[model samples]
Target: MAWSHYREMIVWQKAMDLTDEVYHLARSLPKEELYALSDQMRRAAVSIPSNIAEGYGRQTDREFRQFLSVARGSVFEVETQLEICIRQNYLSVPDAKTALALCDEVGRMLTTLSRH
Candidate 1:
């Protein structure tokens, strides 16, 4: 339970990768989506790792678990938003596979971490 740094945690690292992937996908969206879907996706993607680091800083397992719960919610938010993009034809499933996979991995990691 004693992590030297949030960056040292695989879940946190994977979340960061997911955030980066989301940003890349957001950039490919149409210009009109810049302030709408793009902005929202970026925010949700950021929330994942931000909550992880914030909770890690709390230095208590209980508080950290609570933060993980929040991060997991963000994961769902990103998944929903990504699916919307696909449904709207803004992105292809092929283009989103990496981000979606990252989301799933991060979500599962949060679940396991929260249980601790």
Candidate 2:
């Protein structure tokens, strides 16, 4: 399919889903972490889709690929934060597991999309 908008991209869609999951996970954290780990994780999660959309708005594939790289970095950042949450006992292993799985899926989608 010829995607005319960023929303049409499967990576962006998956990123959106990841973002939602991250937000849900963040809400379960302690209020003391509102400005720390929770906020950082939320920002990283949001960056994936935001960068994808921004890159899609660029005129060249090169620019889009650059943005995809940024999005990929955010995916790793989210993954790392999720790990921290697990280690800190802020998030359960099962909850972190689900978020981590989404991260992997979004990362794979970003890799596939960037290749094009």
User: Pick by lDDT: which candidate is best?
Assistant: 1
RMSD of each: 0.8, 1.2
Clashing residue pairs in candidate 1 are none
TM-score for candidate 1, residues paired by index: 0.97
* 1-116 per-residue lDDT for model 2 (tens digits): 26988898888998999999999999999999999999999999999999999998998999989999999999999999999999999988898887899899989988988887
TM-scores of the models, in the order given: 0.97, 0.95
Angstrom error of the Cα, residue 50, model 2: value is 0.4
Once fitted onto the true fold, the runs of candidate 1 whose alpha carbons sit more than 4 angstroms away are: none
Model 1 alpha-carbon miss at residue 27, Å: 0.5
Error of 2 at 72 (Å): 0.4
What's the alpha carbon RMSD for model 1? 0.8
Worst 10 residues of 1 by lDDT: 1-10
Which regions of candidate 2 deviate over 4 angstroms?
none
